[model samples]
Target: MDGEPGRCGAGVQPRRLTSPGCGSGLDSLERRVRLPSRACGFLPMNYLPFRLLNDRDTFWGLLWSRRLSGSDLLRLMVFIMVACGVYGAIMAGWRSPRLSLYVAIKLPLLFLATTAFVSVFNWMLGLVFRTGLDFRTTIWMVFSAMTLASWILISLAPVSLLFMLSGVPALGTEAELQYAHNGILVTHILVLALSGVSALWVLREGLVRLAAPGCPVGLVLLTWIGMFAFVGCQMGWILRPFVGSPFYPVAFMRPDCLERNFYEFVFGEVMPYLLQGGR
Candidate 1:
């Protein structure tokens, strides 16, 4: 009977998967094995402009949270560049057409080069302090500060333009126009100084968090701030006039840098208001 051609013998039987537990168990297994979507999207930043402008706590949190994702960093860097470019164009445009084009071309370069140099210096200081933050985070934090500066500069553009229009005399004799020129330049310098204060605050907060616990946070902060201002002022000077002199013929850039340092530029030239005080 067992060997009969059309008769079935005992054999392994396949189980049906039609039961509720069977299907549900497989789905449950998949749930256990697969990664959650939230796990995949760790701390993704959105609406950066809002966060950057109005949400300081969130901005600081994001910068320090982890290794920066390249996409986020790139977007932030672009915002910085565009803001700086806007400031450059607005500032130099008030002077002359040639100077505007020149500044527009140079501002982005100035941002990148200065950023890189400062970051390198920052990394060295990090090593001295034995700070644990990575180079990427440090750079990102610094750039975040610079972004604030650039935005402030952009906002001041209208104020600067207004001053240039009303304060700088168009057709006066050189001696007569000198006072107007001086006043406009002094006003712009003061506004830019305010912007520097905002940027320094951003940078200082990040640096404090990153510095080694035993490190003299004060010293480290001052050093970085001094270095940044020194390099930046010199770089600006080297890049030449953002506001060209009406006393001279229009040119895209100066033929050469002035034979003076930042201190000289401020005291000998910019802060002449101090020496002439109460006169």
Candidate 2:
């Protein structure tokens, strides 16, 4: 009786079906696919940096899909600056407060400047390699990976400081001070290398996602990484004094910073010494 087609009280004709499936299907899709959001398609800014570290898949998905807003990028950069500053201060703490302050400023500059300098080359390489990313996306990808490296450094700053304090005496004879300087320098090199490796691991999946149909992602990554490192090493050379030395004054930059780059130093000084077999 109630199932009759013309029954007067028959469920109000299902509310006239304003949208196909009554909008429920679309709502379910959004909930299943998107990152945690306060509003539809909008991630909360305060929680984004944590997501960048912990939810790489979702974060990269949003970035690659062009769904991320300017505010999201701004927040990411702010976190990078602060994280770099923290590690920089720790790196220079062995020298003096003044040197610490100087490095705190320089380290963030180093990362940003390196990214800015290599952006054009990076975008060109992406195009030549058919990576399916534009200039803006290419730069963002490189910078974000660099930021993760900085995050790793920040995470290890305390442990680094502990070792530096215990193993490298702040006040000592000339031989002792030289040993301390070299020790701290080598320690930083190792720590930085580790951070770089970790960042690369995290970015591997993202690289696959951004590559074009037939793109050789490994080759593209190699070229891009080589270029970035080539530029970054020279940038670090120019912005020297990161591992501060008591022998040198606490200046913002070395007086001869522009005289020669890292390559020249390696070829002229380091290579010669190695070739001579320490005499």
Candidate 3:
């Protein structure tokens, strides 16, 4: 009731009435209107946000992630060296005409099998490191690393084979005959030493780029340790088996032996194909 002031009931102020849906009286109605308005429009889409990738971080991360321990690298190097020795044996054996046709066929097949085995081994290594390296990269890295090691072994193969072939006339001793074999062994050591130095250099450069000046001393120490362990273990493993099993008939039969032989053949025989200036 809009009763005028001073005119109603002892001059009391007039009462004013407001509309039900107007401002100051329709809080519930306003809320309902806003809610319905939002529903009629397009719903906000939920999107997964994309982060900008830093190129520098990506490159260095790929380079330095999952660094191999000194022991593991050493183990890998040794395995490669042994593989070279086995390869040399198979190549030498295959040259013999007296071996049966079946043996000849098996020799080539053995080489293929050895390759497959190494491929699998490298794949496993990638898995262990959780590296996203493709199979080709994995194989290439493995082969290149092993080739560096094989240089030493191949250089000494001639001497080792000569020693094995030449028996002492007076002593008639197979042990004495192995002295000639030491030449190939020495060559392998030398080549491995050279390769190790090169590998260490590459590793150092890579680490420096990765860690930057953040932890120079630690990186240097770690690299040094890895190089030493890798070289020493490789040399020791290859020589150890030979010493323990001299004149052992099964020495040439083992897959490990065949693998070593193939490595040597590739480095010694096929390496010429790879040289920029052919000899």
User: What lDDT tens digits, residue by residue, belong to model 2 across residues 63-174?
Assistant: 6556677787777678778988888888888888888898899898898898889889888988988777787777667767877888798999988889768888889899
Could you tell me the lDDT of residue 12 within candidate 1? 19
Per-residue lDDT of model 1, residues 63-91, tens digit only: 55442478877777787778767767766
Model 3 gets an lDDT of 0.37
* Candidates 2 and 3, the one with greater lDDT: 2
lDDT of 3 by residue, 13-60 (tens): 322222333565345323322211121124211100000011211222
Q: Give the range of the ten consecutive residues with the poorest summed lDDT in model 3.
A: 45-54
Give candidate 2 misplaced runs (Cα > 4 Å): 1-33, 37-46
RMSD of 1: 17.9
Candidate 3 at residue 191, lDDT?
A: 47
Worst 10 residues of 2 by lDDT: 12-21
**Candidates' TM-scores?**
0.72, 0.84, 0.32
Which candidate's lDDT is highest? 2
